[model samples]
Target chain A: MPHAIKMQDKYGKDGFVALLLESQGLDASDIPGFMWKRFPTNKTWLSTSGDAPFQMTGGGLPHAALVGVDGTLLWEGNPNGAPKKIEEMVEAELKKSKSGWGKGAIAKKARGLLYGKNAFVDAAKVVADALANAKDDEKEDLEAVAREIELRREAFKKAPKVLSEDARYLEGVKAAENYAKWVKGNPEWENEANAIVLDFQRPEIVKELDLEKGLKKILASAGDKAPTADLAKSLRTFAKKNDGSRMAARATLLAAAAEFDPNKK
Target chain B: MTLSRLVRGVGMVVVLTTAALAQLKVGELVPDKTFAQMLNSDGRKSMAELKGSPVLIDWWGNH
Candidate 1:
């Protein structure tokens, strides 16, 4: 954990990011970009953790993989044994991508500008200046970049607001997911976002999370051949236990699923 | 109720996640997919999903 923290400290802001994946015992506060692999069912871990983009198969622990700007794996090894190799690869990657992606020189300049300052107005100006003399096709491409920047900027602003709107509880999980996605990456707005994530530890929220763990255990037990009557009976008891809380509703819904039959229609 | 029982229950989805391929090689494209089979922590975009940038994925476990 200390080594992971040190790595995040070293490269978290400098044209690089890290993901702390695959842990059973962790809170959101453990790492800035802490995450886990999420299951496909609607019964997700708050939909907070992301997909394993690597699609990796059998490999032991304490591993590392370096992916470059174009999403290609550049290196893989046990990080404990090959720190120097990882650092050298990172340096090589930075030369290829200071940040952002674009094929042409001017479009590349706008992308680099967008990454450097994260200022849509200034990045848009870079595009506007180029658009003045750009060919028709080039103009369309520049306009698309400008739109992408604007959408990102809007999402950044909206995420924190969405998080703030939801009271910190089981109900706020979606809001938490949104904040983690959009309000992140920008250093200026990050602290405010982190403040919201920390709120998940509120006693009320923690209680609900504990209850949720129990709920997951129940779902795990029901399996594919769960007796409908038995499952519904368990869900009803869970709903009663959860009464007056937001999760009571979720319990009710899961209870209905226990009773639902797909072939009815 | 038992750890072994829980393991057996989860093994049902093992087909969706576990493919016993060799380790990832350099130059392969990493596709973001179902991570439930893979142990995950909290929530954050995979650096690859953040569009284009250099990313170092540290795949350590809770040891």
Candidate 2:
């Protein structure tokens, strides 16, 4: 665990994430950062869990695995025996991160297409083939990496305006949320997600995030006591105020329901 | 190292075992696995969730 911490402290900022998997049946105090350990939440280790046992070779203390940005296992063995080899592999993977990948539409479409198909090594041929059948608008979005060094620089760019420009406030917010699931081990892209959320921070946009929470109470929660006409008017108002939002769609449905509810008209 | 080597350090694909998840081998796709019950990771919870960088997973027992 201490060795893990040392590697983490040095390369963590450069996107080298050190995950310490403490095997079961030992005092938690033995972990490297013992004082900082949080319990109950972090107790179970999944790889060796009964549900799906991971087959780790060299059944001994301090075995390690190095996984790359593309989810390929680069190397795995006793760290003590191959420190130089491990570092060498880490360096090679780092170059990929610093030069490869893109964000926003480029990521969601280009790199995503390649990675989803596990055809990253053959990215150019895949893109060229896909382009042959793509529509005009989709064609504009397609870009291929002809060579490893020429991996599109757009991978690290700021949240593209296409992510938020002219889309409904919530749709824009969702774009940022989706990207949150993609990028990792850095602040620049996370900060980009924050900037995107800020782009849609208008009072109306924030209210839309919780539209359903407030809608039913205004539209029908008063039971039969609430006037049918007044409830209908409020529902209409809420829907109109939040037009194009998902909650607005629900509000429209409830507004129509007012047409048949009993309570003496 | 060559450019392809830098982007992807392709090596011999050594399938260590016959199980669903072959043992950690260079240049082979790692089977996606969830790492639940993590004590702390700034909100990251799995190997799949942590992409766009190199990940060093040190599996050790407290002996």
Candidate 3:
């Protein structure tokens, strides 16, 4: 991690950006504190999980991969073992990249102008300003990103203002998925996409659904008959699987209710 | 622990260890997927917006 930060500092002016990916285990919200305590940097920290775009080839805590401005992998290894390799490769990559209007430089500048705020029109303007003197070859991608900004802006503006519990939950789910697709390759829009999904998964959305499923099954059984061993096992499994949620607690209660009373037995 | 369970646990570990070691190769185009979330000084960022510049992706964690 330190090696990566050092590289970012040394090569950052030459259009080198360091992205630290928090691979699994920790909650998304925990990243800032984690980075601050251990891996502090002005660079951004991204969380990658099951849907990670890149895969690791070996087991280790710190795996590094250097990608060129055109997004091709240029080097891959443990940074600690081959620190010189990264420096050499970045220099080579810098030479190959177009000096003034390289993709990486443009993307980095555009991202700096877009992060943390929600106004798509405002973002589009910022992006437009960054690209105002862009080379002819850079215009296409710049336009595409600007177009995406407008699309996302329109989508959010169109989202319904009021919805019932279930409808709201479903809408949130749909919106998150849609935004996820919209920003599929664009890291600049990841924060908004993350917020959408987090808001949708807020416990309340799944609370009623869990209660309805859990209680309906418990109430359907015949009067005073102890739940069969198989039913007890399944209910226990369900509760365990959903642990920490309200539904899980309800499932546990239902399981207890199904237990055979000693007096009756 | 039963011998069978112990062997199974070791086998699972080996399998996972092997899987974890498989990293990206040089020269391959990196996948352009959006990260779940981003932590940054200015705020969150997306991988998509990171094009045109050389990016060094460090996959690391405390746990």
Candidate 4:
């Protein structure tokens, strides 16, 4: 929760925006109070109930996904887990003109699809299709991914039963695996699932690391590649083709940087 | 710094930025997932309205 706020604070001025979606069927009355205390930022906070984009890709609660200025999804995971990479992408986006990449038709289409209907199922289908094409040896790893998606779907399916009883049970979706055992032990909690007390606890984050300096050092050594002028030309074409996509914006920014000739100018 | 060093620095930023761009597996297309209706102090809002800038969508609850 605090990390999201910190990120907005650090990057908001650089054209970064953060949004919080409460996917659980919680009572809306309690959100403002929670928001006032925990996340005081003016960032958009909304309450959502059924299928969401995060249901497919998120590891758990507090999951954060980064959408680049041009509309591409740059990173998705715990915001704290990859602080440096997030900053790297944000910095890259900030370097571009605000209107350059995000206004294109393709980028808009992609963003719309991400926020549109049946996203979880769509993501699962994507996984299933990829798995179908995978070699036999890759089955185990792919199956694990598929299993997780199925588990989440099952968990989401079981949520209404629990939420109908108590609106505040945030862990109900996650506790689907333990539902059978829990119901057998506590009969009352079978239908009134939210009333069941969970023994599970959340682990605390230990440390936050900064790796950008090291990454910059490695970059300094990576000087030999495509010629600046050639890269700039290719990137401009890429930007025009991709239009409002994140790659195009990033390419446009990079192209300008590459073509900078100090001696000539 | 010397002109050569300055040029190298610029090259480095470009190199690292390109590498970072390559790491992005998912494009910016928003999923067509069913979103619960959004409400706030004002009224209703859609996720699509959040486009035109970098956004961090936190799919979380009061857990």
Better of 1 and 2 by lDDT: 1
lDDT of 3 by residue, A1-265 (tens): 8887888778776667778776756654444444533433335444534235568667876788888765678887788988987889888767554332325466444433333233344456656786788777677768765765564454442342122222333444555565555454445666667666666555675674545555556545533333555665666787787777655665565465455342321
TM-score of each: 0.47, 0.44, 0.43, 0.37
> Tens digit of lDDT per residue, candidate 2, span A1-265?
5555656666665667776666654343233123123221222222333222245677776788888877787787888787777777777777666555543344344454344332342445445666677666556555423332133222322223332222233444655555544443336655765665576677766676567567856834545342365676788898899898867775675566454332221
Tens-place lDDT per residue, model 4, A1-265, is: 6666677778765546666676555444455434533443434545544334534364466677887654557788887678788777777766542323223333223223222321334445545666666665555555644554444434444543344233212333334434433334333434444433222222210000012222223324334343345555766775676575434454565456455543331
Query: What is the lDDT, from 0 to 100, of the residue A85 in candidate 3?
Result: 76
Which residue segments of model 2 deviate by more than 4 Å?
Answer: A27-53, A101-265, B1-22
Query: Which sequence of candidate numbers ranks them by DockQ, best first?
Result: 3, 2, 1, 4
Q: What is every candidate's C-alpha DockQ against the true complex, given to 2 decimals?
A: 0.23, 0.26, 0.29, 0.22
Model 4 spans with C-alpha error above 4 angstroms: A41-44, A48-51, A102-265, B1-25, B32-44
Over the stretch B1-63, how does candidate 1's per-residue lDDT look in tens digits? 999998987895684456432346778766654333212222322332343456666554444
Could you say which candidate leads in DockQ? 3
* lDDT: worst 10-residue window of model 3 chain A: A157-166
Fnat for each model: 0.54, 0.61, 0.69, 0.58
The better-scoring model by lDDT among 1 and 3 is 3
Query: Comparing candidate 1 with candidate 3, which one achieves the higher TM-score?
Result: 1
Q: Tens digits of per-residue lDDT for model 1 on A1-265?
A: 2344455557655656555454343432222222211111211122224334554444576766677765678877677787777777776666555555665677777776655545555577788889889988677778867776765554444433333233224434654555455535556556655666677777877777777777777867756343356767787898898897656666675576566543332
For model 3, fnat equals 0.69
Off by over 4 Å in 1: A1-3, A23-50, A92-101, A128-151, A161-265, B1-29, B32-49
